[model samples]
Target: MNTRPPAARQIVIGVVLLVVVAMIAFLGSLASMPHTDGWYAVAAKVDWSPPNSVFGPAWSILYFLIAVAGWMIWRNGWRENQPNAAQKTLTIYTVQLALNAIWTPIFFAGYPLIGEPAWWIALVVIIALILCVIWLAVSAWKWSKPASLLMIPYVLWLVFASSLNAGVIALN
Candidate 1:
């Protein structure tokens, strides 16, 4: 009895999802570049504007983890069997991704950017925290405590990012 589905299919799904998520995150990073090097970057330039080298690569790694985490949940026989939580989780994942992608434009491209990037930063923090909860539950669904454990750093990183965003807004 093939209790589990195909590992190959799950791996493929993981890869594709990772790529898509990375692309979206990268695009959002690019969209924010003009401001990063200009207004916000210049104004916030001191000893701590965040290392440019760290941002994109860090986000890419996070996206990859996200894809793997999602695939793990899917492979737990939840996507089809535990339809409700699975659906909610996936929907939250998409919403968080969309929110992550949109924050750049709102803070960078919009005229009268308003309270600076603080608002977008706060929103990202909230969304990321929600995702952490979702991912934790998704991991728990499979009785994989280690898997749920993996998302802790990610949640902490988001908290750090919120602080950085606040710092930037405060400086600039």
Candidate 2:
């Protein structure tokens, strides 16, 4: 038998796992973005563009903050008498993550890469929804400040990504 609160160490571990998964997903998505396509959009094929360099470090830091967000969610789950709030918030989280996961393959690894950018628009929707829910949860005291704060990078990235996607649609 074990004796531990529902929001005990398991929540922390889960948060860490979420962060690791976020980093891997971010890296994977990079493999398919515009600059990585090897078409030399702005420079030599092998050259490092500003976006790629900026993205790498920014995403690394984002991953750390995201983990903290997960922890906050877990703590919130513990405080609730039932799983209602946790389930809803986590469902939104899962939806966003799933959308995030699919973006790379569509934009980068898709067979023809023709319809890939549309997927990015969809990703934008997911990100927007996620931000809304996170804001609600934080405001309602269902989640911690750290969790909301951690997601700031993700929100920022999505805003940038939405613009990039539009540019891609226009250019390509």
Candidate 3:
């Protein structure tokens, strides 16, 4: 007899999750020192590279979407009592987040300093990152269609990032 739809709780949790995701993304950006010291300025970029100004806003939007998608999945799983699927989906999501976090430092800082092995390592990481997002998209589709729809931009961005990463590897 108490079906109020729980919007308040969901909103709170979603906002909290958004902050957490933003923090994680901020830390990743910090670790990369992406803008402060002109690290990216020296990197060899292909003609298709977007302006440096685009990355910050693009990533901010993507991360917000990512958090919302995760929150949607979390809310559904909590309501439906599907702990196993939730766990798997969250695990994939976490892995992708971790991969996204490390990519900037690895590609921009580590690879350039260490030479060939580092470059190869960055490529491997990017490939793994791509795989993780793909998994996230598929798992989200199975768990929540809206969540899956939410992930499309992130997936597309990652695909573009993979090409950029590959280009960096080839050029530098």
Candidate 4:
């Protein structure tokens, strides 16, 4: 909005926005959690798979990074002269977040309900997510280097997660 509130007020807005994004991501995770212990507990996994204990903290950190990254890019895009760019960036952010929110349920809930087809669907969803993440980073890099850099950890985590999904498919 660049209505240019005082710097302190602007910072408050940024903080609130980031917190809201992170909270939304966290809430989405809750949806997938109920689906986990069912089939996921018994699902075969790769030897390299980290313990179940690792996911919560890892995702928590990644969600914060993603939130800040999104805010940085969106903030940059919203400059007075850049409304069109802001719209495009917002679209990228929405698509990736939508994909992220759905993936776990597809992989975790879908398997128990639909069998192997669920994993396949999850795989497709993840690949799309990875693409969207890359798109977000590229767009972010153009607007803010810090924003793009924040995505690196997310990329690494998603790659590891993708392999885990693939491993389960092969093992089961």
**Per-residue CA lDDT of candidate 2, range 23-52, in tens?**
666666665565365642532322222456
lDDT of each: 0.62, 0.56, 0.76, 0.80
After best superposition, candidate 1 residue 11: deviation in angstroms? 3.0
**Maximum-lDDT candidate:** 4
Q: Which parts of model 3 have CA positions greater than 4 angstroms off?
A: 1-9, 34-39, 80-85
Among these predicted structures, which one has the highest TM-score? 4
What TM-score does candidate 4 get on C-alpha atoms? Answer: 0.86
Instruction: Compute the lDDT for candidate 3.
Output: 0.76
Considering TM-score, which of the candidate structures 1 and 2 is the better prediction for this target? 1
lDDT of 1 by residue, 86-158 (tens): 4555555566566666655665654245656445655565566656555655645554445455566567667
Considering lDDT, where higher is better, how would the candidates rank from best to worst?
A: 4, 3, 1, 2
Pairing residues by index, what is the TM-score of model 3?
Answer: 0.84
For all predicted structures, in order, the TM-scores are 0.73, 0.66, 0.84, 0.86
User: By TM-score, highest first, what's the ranking?
Assistant: 4, 3, 1, 2
lDDT of 4 at 97: 86
Each prediction's RMSD over C-alphas, in Å, is: 3.7, 5.4, 3.0, 2.7
* Candidate 2 error regions (>4 Å): 1-8, 19-23, 26-37, 40-49, 79-85, 111-141
